[model samples]
Target: MAPKSDSAEAIVLNFVNEQNRPLNSQNVADSLQKFNLKKAGIQKALDNLADSGKISFKEYGKQKIYLARQDQFDIPNSEELNQMKEENAQVQQQLDEQKRAISEVEGEIKNLQSNLTLEQIRHKEAKLQKEVKEMEDKLVKLRKGVTLVRPEERKAIAEMYSEKLSQWRKRKRMFKDVWDAITENLPKDLKEFKEELGLEYDEDVGVSLQSFSGLLQHGKK
Candidate 1:
């Protein structure tokens, strides 16, 4: 089966890398004729590769000329080299900012836990954890050079993250309701006594309400 023709994107990228020169979509499509790829597929693959930073492009009037990312590095002029250095510096700054943001969120979680009730603590912790995780995921993608330049595309990404934040909030609310209902009448003495016994709900004890209630009942007996 002619090795399954690789992928359309891979074929397009390989052809550009081998040619080591800027090529229009038609040039790419012509080169891949042996692979029986369609012009539309070749064009889409080229666009995607460029968007992902695996390939670079130049604009000539209405046409976008595509070339392999490595091709740009191979024979860099002084200006191009300086631009690459600036781009690297920007990426490093972004990484530092993401790390600082993560640390700040962690500090906030710790501070909130100090003065918050158990339910409040859990709610804040869950919300912050979700945010931190999302940031970390974005940092990884950024480190991999995933760039989204379109405003509408960025808006879609923001909406997706907002949905995730909402889901986290809903989870925190559910857990808070369950926790408040179960411990509504829990005496202060018993609460202190549970702490004294060190039967704290470590992950080993399980995270369910039943586990906590069981520990309280055991203490009473």
Candidate 2:
């Protein structure tokens, strides 16, 4: 059944139809800014619009912006429309291929990063494991009365092992890089770490690893 009440959505759509700017949530919000309505909630309501012919989509920056598409937008000739569609499809295809290639390269870089990180962790863990083994060996000899274990000596061993345990924990925590130089694989701990460090994470703030890597590789000239 059609919605029993579509007043709010109807209002938003009608407003868009009335003012035919390259509209976005901000535009819609700006239209309603004088009212007591929540501008943020207005954006949300518009976002929930159904795909059944009332709403239209356009990509602005990295987000989808909506507008109304109804009877009035003049129809182009079938051949020209088809040609436009074909060109759009070609561009979309090229974009998809580029994205796929970028994704593959990013995956390789992340894997390399993960592997390198794990290798470093493994090295530290190995060194700590060796220390643990060496401590156990020394304790065994001391137990046999081969040499007396001083109180400070015992404290030193305990402290060393505790430090090693803490180091291993830190390494294990950083096992994966979710944010790579490309950001396709940013560190999994990134958000938490950022939160802990009181940092803000901006989605579009920084250069992606792929672009940055390209700059480093090719920009020298």
Each prediction's Cα lDDT score?
0.78, 0.68
Residue lDDT tens for model 1, 83-170: 9999999999999999999999999999976886988879999999999999999999899988735778767766665565567557
lDDT of 1 at 191: 60
- Reference-based TM-score of each model: 0.31, 0.29
Q: Which stretches of candidate 1 lie over 4 Å from their true place?
A: 1-5, 71-221
| Worst ten in a row by lDDT for model 1 | 212-221
Off by over 4 Å in 2: 1-6, 70-221
Evaluate model 1: give its TM-score.
0.31
Q: List the residue pairs that clash in candidate 2.
A: 178-185, 178-186, 178-187, 179-185, 179-186, 179-187, 180-185, 180-186, 181-209, 182-209
Q: Give the Cα-based TM-score of candidate 2 against the true structure.
A: 0.29
